[model samples]
Target: MVTVTAAVTEASSELIARARAGDDEAFQALTEPYRRELHVYCYRMLGSVQDAEDALQETMLAAWQGLAAFEQRASLRTWLYRIATNRCLNTRRTAARRPATQWSVPGVEPPEPTRLGEVAWLEPYPDSLLDEAADAPPGPEARYEQSESVSLAFVTALQLLPPRQVAVLVLRDVLGFPAREVAAMLDATVESVNSALKRARAALRRRPPRAQHEPAPPAGSAAEDAIVAKFVNAYESADLDALVALLTDDVFISMPPMPFEYEGLSAARDFCALFLGTGREYVLVPTRANGQPAFGLYLRADGVCRATSLLAITLAGNRVCALSRFDGSVLPRFGLPQSLPDGP
Candidate 1:
């Protein structure tokens, strides 16, 4: 194992040397391995897929330009993360993020919302991309599981945090980077990093706790399938009672890019009734987002089903704990079509 490891390291070093010498292919080879994970990190930081993509491109460009200065004191992965994190911080600070969209469905008046959500620019991360970065393991200091860290609820909570606290928390708790390494990455002292982490943790804890609910069923397990199947059936049939029965007592609902949010079972029920009570028929194309069950929602009218939105749910045991509705504009990111032919 030692010999194999040394040989792999030697090859990586050679790739780095070639990349530094301006070999574009070598540079691509060196950075490609970290690209998906870096993108995920950026998504966690920025909350928008488009913004994450932009940050990722900028990070790669900066890395390539600064390759000569990479002294290899840290693993290349950590170095990439440092670049990605800083790039995301810059974006969070300067970018004009997407604005909140209004409730504009034709002939449908949504019930009064429970409250306006703060994270209006949030977008779902496609699970397909996550498969490519599956092997990333958090360090010993990590406080969240990999799947939990990527959930819609967790990511939404992250967006509410200040950018520096988000960075510190993600590096120290989510990705499990050591305090010294995180401080080095952020060009700060370890003491400051620790302080930021403490504040971030406290802020996160102050947010509503999902820990009180039972754990979600394992991905793709029978338990999960049963819940998803019931959701599809209830939603398609417009059976409000059946759908409501599948929700936890405190089930939360929010539509991003649109500020509407509904919390608790009653509010969720009202929102669902308003949405489903419309005379139009519907269909759901299954997909996964942010490590949770998601579907491309389509409105069937005049024998054609047109995409309307994407819905991702957070399950606590057999019942859903939260539902996130994203704009239909994100369907392409998950390889879902904009429209589908009406089913028999």
Candidate 2:
């Protein structure tokens, strides 16, 4: 039998050639490398993980069907991106805005320290993938840097803009696409593109100043470990008082898909006491999201176990200013098991 390595190499080479020659399967192979990243891009655009997945699938199908019309004028990667962006834009036109969940699923709720409208649409992407993307291959000049683009704050801020603005900001600022190329992708004039970018920047600038971010926690950092432990314990125990202590005086919290957010320690504390950790019991299964610390917050409903939601936290100077809970369905994406050990 041929070795697996040899098979993969041979298959990749054959696919690339065949795809160039109009073979759909070959095109699929050539585009597979971009699928995950494109999905992430779409997700960031839509602010709904479900919408991103749908857009990605549609983009792939469109690329496959449109291969015959593709010219070599642009790199295959760029061509794929153009298809994905158009797909997301089209989806955005018809997609309904899902109200943010106050508490995930029946009875399993985490502390809701904020209202949905105060912050931008907040969702979680697998931390593992974000980390992987941080080290992924970059082109000759590394036009776009993934290091901070995938952060919770960054992604949250992105959703506050209109879809076109989202696309323009991400392409020009995050992905570093040239204005000319961005115009072509959006089918707008360069002047129009420039105006959109200006507006996007202005909108972002008008928002309150965000706290500084530390890239990734050091492996053996006692500070982070302790904070995480205390956070998890306070949350799992439903101890509102202890939980409040971990927060900074001006900490903020927001949940997207819902229009609730909270600012300041007092507001956050009220939310935890009134909505979450009041009648709910939680078990935090450690996980990662948006290249930062995170967890799968499972809840005990009556006497049965069920998944609640995924929590992604952003830390600043040893305190958490932002804590977001993405929908529970996102668990699988981060490779987290659906169930966890029952509490003692």
TM-score of each: 0.97, 0.81
lDDT tens digits, residue span 139-257, model 2: 34223457467776777778778889889888887777778888888889999989998999899889878555544455337877888999998997888888888887777766565
TM-score of 2: 0.81
Tens-digit per-residue lDDT, 214-333, candidate 1: 988999999999999999999999998999999999898988988999989999999898878877677999999999999999999888999999999999999999999888999999
Candidates' lDDT values, in order?
Answer: 0.91, 0.73
Assess the local accuracy of residue 278 in candidate 2 as a C-alpha lDDT between 0 and 100.
Answer: 56
Summed over model 1, clashes come to: 1
Task: Per model, state how many residue pairs clash.
Answer: 1, 13
User: Which pairs in model 1 have colliding backbones?
Assistant: 101-257
lDDT (C-alpha) at residue 328 in model 1? 94
The superposed Cα distance between candidate 1 and the true structure at residue 148, in angstroms, equals: 0.6
